[model samples]
Target: MNNLPIGFYVDNLYCFPVGPSGSQRFCYLPTTPRIEVLGNEVKARILNSDDAAVLALQIVWEADTDTIEKAKSEIKNRYPELSFINLSLADFRGVTATLNINKNDKVIYSIGPINTSGPDMFRAAFQDTLKSAEKEAVLNAFNTGESGVITIVYDGYLKLNEIADAEFDGDLATEIKALAPREVEEKGKGFFSKKHKILTPSPSLQECKDAVGKAIENKSLIIQHKDSANVSKKAKDTVIQEIINDISQCVFTKIEEVGKNSQYISSYCCRIKKTKAESVKFNLKKSYDLVGTISESRGRDIIEK
Candidate 1:
């Protein structure tokens, strides 16, 4: 079994708690991978040597020196066909090892160092790093037309610290409760969120009269003929008169011919006598269609002209 390709191994030398007070320390030396339980400081069975180094770190964090030594001894006795080197996290320097199974079989191992403050932090960082390394290694092996399993092993011990619960004073808690609830700002969907204005079609003639009356009171009116090919001079003059009769005041400007397709159209710029602000106060119902028709007929380019 030892002659078969094993997994990757990473070794690190870090301080370990040795005594009851958890202060007595030593440089942890992990030779074989093992399983350990947290808090209870229990060393479980030795894991297969092919296990990942990050996994070993989990067990190693909870393991004591004697347990680790015994596990190492057992591995040596059980798998004499396999050979491994003792590496420390402190001395880690991108070392790689290869296990020779037979004339045809070989497994490669990449080792590295992890700098962490405590077992909890180490566990999180080690898990992320190991996952990345495993992915990379598998991809590399596949690219080389090779098949192999990735095993990570880390040798080191991290001191476990008891996390304290947070406490709040009675006055502070009361103050917090007295604070007003924060209002959540509505966020737009950025480029995806759009306010589309659904324009109503032109209103009926009666509706147009009402809207024109209101619009003239507040807003200036600008009317321009758009359909040069279809609209006649009589139609234009009739429309302008209809508007003038409905509005309180109307001023008809000079007609200007536009368009190059032998299509002549006139523009009638008129203004309401009321101030812009007062004109806005006029509320007319069902005037949207008339306004829409006026705006659309003028065409967007008409503003520039």
Candidate 2:
């Protein structure tokens, strides 16, 4: 029978007791990976090599070595705290002897660095060793435990798709062109001087929705004209208005929580477009106030909300 199965090797180097800290408050100190556990030690799972390094640093910021060496030491110090029973390549002796193994053979472990430049140089070397020892048919031989030279080869590939259909047709294009803006004469600067208006702040979310419903009911212009093609540009403008109306009709709920306090606010806007929606979401909670302006062209206005 094989001496080892599908399980990880564990080593405990150091540990300490901690209290009252968030995210598991315990501190253990060990210089190396495999120190014997004492009877009065804290309870935790084993740590994988990478996790061991991380945990060691979490417990104490400094390790007694440079990058790679520090990583190894940290791993050694905390390997016993991990829960998974993965076999360690470091613990296995014949791991170096038989480098040939099938990729699908269900090897007990995978080993790699925290980061690698380009392809991992260590993994590349390891793969080369496996190819040399296995020869070919690595997977089949590994699955059956057959006594023969095995070879494993893996091919990587990618796929792409080309666009086939265009959604904008002749009618849609003609309508869209009609919606383009035409310049009009500028308004007199003193036009609003006689009328003094109070700048009231926007209402809460519920009030905003009620106001939007009232405005839409009053406009009576939600539907686009089918025969608007005679005035192609006008028809396109109507379509754009329809799109804005559809967007404004959709309601979004907002909830904000601060420490022990929580509040819900609902709001709506009349002029909703793709660009405006993006800007609103991007600047949310920062700029809550809105303003409006009229266009020189007839029946054209821009509202920022």
Candidate 3:
């Protein structure tokens, strides 16, 4: 009987350099072939340790098992950073690859090594991998037709770009006034009085209003749902409250209230604010977020910087 057409499995691939600085010699570690091929199952192990850079990857396939061994072998030889050991074939359903890395280590899988060369090359390679993975994910999702709602909390502060684009309430007004400058005047001999001047258009207030209004207008629940009225009133209430909480938590990062339009600042701020706001909007509208984040920025410092 012919050996089952099995894919290749690489146990561990490692790269370490030797010789003097700037004239270093490097090659794969001396060890058992870290790669293995089993009927439909391929496995490999790899390690990346470089003074300046390192990478480790394990590639596997679910189709065309017969070509996996050849494919892996070719790839390994071309990329010295890769290693293939324990050449064997067996009966299995899938292949596996693993890399040993520190908790803080960042790993990237690319068609080629990233060098002093501009990210252009790396980006192209990265894109190919991403496209492949994305295609697979989208296909899987489409085939499974599985989706649901997810609720996310967003909280942060933003500066006013223009004024009055979004409505403002007392709570919002208070937060804005707290961040403004105060004027001092002398009253005769030793007595002095201070008056507070409203220097900028407070967009935070409007942000709150816009955020809440948007949720209401879209009939979106902060808690997240998939176009379902099956949600209990309590759940619905929770979602609304969470939306409010997120808006209220936002702090104005920058205030550009000088333009005659007054709205210019508010509009500009909203655009930037969307990074975090969009997540809330997504949860409210689609019942789930395919992308986005809700964490608030540290403060206005990031914006001003």
By TM-score, the best candidate is 3
TM-score (C-alpha, index-matched) for candidate 3: 0.18
Which residue runs does candidate 1 get wrong by more than 4 Å?
A: 1-28, 35-62, 65-112, 117-124, 129-148, 153-305
Give the CA lDDT, 0 to 100, for residue 124 in model 2: 17
Against the true structure, whose lDDT is highest?
A: 1
lDDT for each residue of candidate 2 in 1-305, tens digit (9 for 90 to 100): 11211122223222221211111222222222111123633111222231121111001111222333443444445545533222111211111111223335443322221221111111112222123222233322323434322221211111111111111111112211222223334544695745443322223444434443454456532322222101234434544544534433332121111211111222222333221110000110110000001112210111001
Q: Is candidate 2 or candidate 3 better by TM-score?
A: 3
Instruction: Please tell me which model should have the higher lDDT, number 1 or number 2.
Output: 1
lDDT of 3 by residue, 1-305 (tens): 01211122333322222221122222221112111234533222112122211111222212233444554465457445535333222222111122211112222222322221121111111112123333333223223432211111111111111111112222233333443333344344434755444434345555745654565466442232221211234544444555555544443433224322333222221111111111011010011121111111211111110
The RMSD of every model to the true structure, in order and in angstroms, is 37.2, 29.5, 27.3
Error of 3 at 191 (Å): 6.9
Q: lDDT of candidate 2?
A: 0.24
Stretches of candidate 3 exceeding 4 Å from the true structure: 1-227, 252-264, 268-305
Cα-based TM-score, every candidate? 0.17, 0.16, 0.18
Model 1, residue 255: distance off in Å is 99
**Which candidate order results from sorting by lDDT in descending order?**
1, 3, 2
